[model samples]
Target chain A: MVRVALYTLLGVMSVVMVAPLVYMVSLSLQTEAETLSAQAVLWPENPQWGNYAELFVKAPFGDFIVNSFVVAGGITLAHLLFDPLVGYVFAKFRFPLRNTLFVALLATLMVPFFVRMIPLYVLMAQLGWLNTFQGLITPFLMDAFGIFLMRQFIQPIPDDLISAARVDGASEFTIYRKIILPQTKPALAVLGLFTFVFQWNEFLWPLVATTTPEMRTIPVGLTLFNQEYFTLWHLTAAGSVILFVPTAILFLVSQRYFVRGITLTGLR
Target chain B: MSLSARYARTAYLFLLPALVFFTAFFYVPIANVIATSLHTGPQADVFAGLSNYADALADPSVRHSFLVTLGFSGGVVAGSLVFGLLLALVLDQPLKGRVTFRAMLLVPYLTSVAIVGLLWRNILDPQLGILNRLGLDQQWLNEHPLATIVGVTLWQTVGYTMVLFLAGLQGIPETYQEAARIDGASAWQRFWRITLPLLAPTTLFVSVMAVISGLQAFGQAYIITNGGPGDATDLSVFHIYATAFKTRDFGYSSAQSVLLLVVIVLFTLMQLRAGKRGEVTY
Candidate 1:
């Protein structure tokens, strides 16, 4: 009896959780008249695949997707490369001011991005980087969280592995490349996925940084699309789906790592 | 050369990129924000100490924005915790489809906030919303705007909090519950005596995170209502954005941003105090 109650509760909660996404897709499939009709249906009688096609035609949505990929991809690549390098140093190397530097990075994590927004915008504007990809991508290229995550993951590798490599006359960079890099692949994956999803879904900074439609990322572009075409629910839903589906796929493909990433960073 | 010196040099080489980036992007900008907050004008060269802060504090809109921010954060934190803990407990059961349910719930979290705002805005539209068709005629975005924003934020965030709680729940050893069960403790008694006490740390962490994110909420208000219907849903961050970007009040916005930082720091300190007072050795 208890088991039945639990399943039923879970079933209702799952529907409530998933209803918006279902509604989004369903609304996207409806014609404009059907969408604005007096009676709203969960599923449209006639599926309108044309809404998806209309998204590309109505806006430079294809460019927005490309921009999203490029920005997210660039940030992820930078994090994968730089964060692990710094993490490896903090993990394996006994260096001057290492602990202090690590603490400083952790402290930076506490300073919310909003505090720096005005000045960062000014700096970007001064550098003539406003509306540019570099403006959107540069400040976020390497974050304190990524470095911290990489350090925790890299600390577990045995010291002897690095010692042996050094004794064989391997350089620090080579050791990082050959031994540490391969060992830290799982951490790298987690950091990479986290950065990618974050950058892809990032809205405020991109919205603030980029002004032109062409420079806008998927989320920003879709929002602008909504603001302009507020009444067209079908097109707006389609645009949201276009912006959302890629990240959803990424999350599903690496659901385990995504959850682990949240739990690991969440505690800190 | 000493071994330590060699290691230090190599480490410095590795650290160069991060240090440079942090200096250029993080440290300098923060210093600039503080420096600018005390000054006047777009160029911000003229010194006008505390004036911007005074203006920001005295402004009715700013005061209203802070109140709305508090209400919104409080609602989100409460809603997420209550609902999230319940969902976590339900999913913790050895049900056959728990994994599938958990994954399905996480879709909202994976979706972007901007998209969430757009989707919810459509769903809550008074004239054309499906909810209206179901006999609810309230204007969600316009009427009870704070509740609407909080509900949308809860939708996007509760799954994440659930995942965190689930991890915490799983970390708890089964032996304690089993021992309580063997001692003739009812399920409610076991939960109240054993589980609730143990879950305190996770609860604190989740609430702190929710509060921090809630205070910083912007996209929902900006996207859904544009802080509209007479500033009903204007939040601190969105207010700051308007002051700085829309109204071209950099100094004032910087002051507001400083105040926000202060609010966040106080919350963090409170969490530290709570964590210290409620330190569970287990």
Candidate 2:
């Protein structure tokens, strides 16, 4: 009897959790008239596959997808290259003011992005970067969390490996390039995926940073769709599906790493 | 040079790029925010002192926004915590399709907030929404704006909290519960004594995170209600955004941002204190 109750509860919660996503796809496939009809069906009698086609033609959604990829991919690549290096040095090398600097980096983690939003926007405007890719990507190129994550991941590598490499006349850069980078793949994967999904889903900054329709990322781009077609549920749903596809695919591909990343970063 | 000295030099060289980037983007911008908050004018360079803060604090709309923000965060934190813990406990049981359920639960967390806002707005539409079709005909985004936004946020976030709690739950040694059972403890007693105490760290972490994110929640409100029904759902972050962008009051917006910074910093300090108290250690 207890077991039955547990399953039923789990079953219900799962349905509640997943129904919105299912409904989103279902709504996207229905015509506007069908969706608004009194006898609206959960699943459209005739699935309007044409809504997806119409969305692409009406808006620069294809450009939004491309822009999202460019921005997310750029941030991910920058972090992949820079953060690990910073983490390696902090983990393996000792220096004056090292602890202070490390603490400073960690301190930035507490400074919420919204606090910096206005000034950052002003800074971007001053730099002539508004409505530009650099505006979207530069401020977030290297995050405190990425550096901290890398430091934690890299600290576990034995010091002897670096010492041995030093004894063998390998330069510090060589040791980092060859040894530290190779050993920290799991951490790097987690960081990269986290950064990608974050940048891909980022709304506020991208919304403010880019003014032109051509430069908008997927999330910000969808808001335009929302404004222009407030009543067109099918097209908006289609746009939402487009916005969600990349992050969903990444989540599915690296499910375990994504969970591990969240736990390690203490972020959702 | 000594080996230690050489290592220090090399390390500084290695750290140069990140330090420069951070100084320009993070440190300088934060400093600019502070400076801007104190000054008047569009450029925000002219010295005006605390009038911007005075105006922000005195504004009824700003005060309403603060209350709305608190209410939204409170609802989300409470709902997500209770439901998340329950879901985690349920998933902890030996059950079929556990992995699938976990994956399904994580879907909303992975989706973009814009997409979530759109999806939920569609789902809660008064005329065509599934909820309305089920005979719940209330205007979700208009009349019950806070509840609607909170419900959407809870749906998107509860799974994340559940995952964290699941990790916490699994980390708990089974012996405690088993021993409690042997000692004639009821399930409720065992939960209260063994489970709750052990899960305190996770609870603290989850709540702190929820509070921080909930306070800064803008995307959902922006998309769903546009801080609508006469500012019924206007949050602090959205208020700040409007002050800066809509009203072109960069100084006042910066002041509001400073206030938000104070709130976030306080919560973060609490988290740090909790960490120091060793409650987070399992």
Among the numbered candidates, top DockQ falls to 1
Local distance difference test, each candidate: 0.89, 0.88
Consecutive 10-residue window with the lowest summed lDDT within model 1 chain B: B273-282
Model 2, range A236-265, lDDT digits (tens) per residue? 889888878788888888899988887886
Q: What is the DockQ (computed on Cα atoms) for candidate 1? A: 0.82
Angstrom error of the Cα, residue B74, model 1: value is 1.1
| TM-score of model number 2 | 0.97
Interface RMSD values for all candidates: 1.1, 1.2
- Candidate 2: segments with Cα more than 4 A from true spot: B271-282
